[model samples]
Target: MRRFFAIGLLAIHLFNIAGYSLVFQYFIYQTDTNLITKLDLNQYRESELIQFKIPISVPYIADRPDYERVDGQVEIKGVLYTYVKRKIERDTIYLQCLPNRVTQRLSKARNAYTKHVNDLPQSKKNQTGSTIKKSGIFSEYDFKTLDYQFAAPLATASTYISYLSPSPVPGALEVPGKPPENRG
Candidate 1:
């Protein structure tokens, strides 16, 4: 009897663990999350920056986003994010995000970069070079006057006009004693 009781207790415990595991899995699947880790952006290589495009219902933020200046913590569907600049086009959304603490460092780097660029001496725009005027036969020809328009087939224009025209109303024209043609 004791052995049976022990087996029963073990079975109960196993079932409880399984139930909890299933519930946790469900919770994870239901949650909408974006994990912004340090590997997302490399300060040395600007091209390696990670961009997240999420399709969700959000208010129109901006058409052209200035990611550097925009600073805020956004809570999107219960998920918290920092330094995320959003651009919503139609139904889709583009998210540019950076880690919370890294924002200051990025700003500092940007300032230093701009200062360094400004300090550099400006190079002379026009450099004198030896030039030889060409006297080729083709040089006298006026290439701009030549027509480059594509010569489309006459049938294509007719087909396009037909497509643009409104479709005929069904049964709009009925002949006497003839079963109405199903134009549709």
Candidate 2:
């Protein structure tokens, strides 16, 4: 009777463990599926944006102003030259890709870095600029993994301009300005 009772208890424990293991495995699978689904949704949004070009604004430093003062008489001050100064211009935003899971991660990281930079009271966000010059997708065979490469034009000075600007301005540039003159 004692031997039978011990064996029965062991059997019950084993069965319970097996059930828990199965449940845990199911839960993990579900979680992984959900993650993949979310990634897919992000990918879809990125694809949609690829069909249309978005504008990205970047800031650049302009030329600094200088002033000069001259004296006509040895004893009295004569003239003062005042310089005309202009503030830095705001950058144009060119959206290369929409916020997808992968790019979203990149964007978040960038935002965090920007925030940290801004926290430095001395740092200026308006003086910074960035431009996405080229981008493309590449896929790996084994996992069918797709990735993108973005090249941006950045300037430390607020007066700088993008090396390459996207052709056809977002909405304004669409209208034709003037027809080319006929050449004989």
Candidate 1 lDDT: 0.47
Model 2 worst lDDT window (10 residues)? 67-76
The TM-scores, one per candidate, come to 0.21, 0.18
Tens-digit lDDT string for candidate 2 (1-184): 9999999999888655454444544654554455445544543343333221223354454422332221111111322111111122233211222222432343334445445533533234344454222121332233666899997877564785556557655334565678889999
Question: Candidates' lDDT values, in order?
Answer: 0.47, 0.39
Candidate 1 residue 93 C-alpha distance from true site, Å:
1.7
Q: Which portions of model 1 miss their true places by more than 4 Å?
A: 1-45, 58-69, 74-81, 101-184
Candidate 2 steric clashes: 17
Predicted candidate 2: what Cα RMSD to the true structure?
32.4
Pairs with steric clashes in candidate 1: none
lDDT of 1 by residue, 33-120 (tens): 2223322343323443346687766565454443442334554553444543556566666666543433334433433443343453
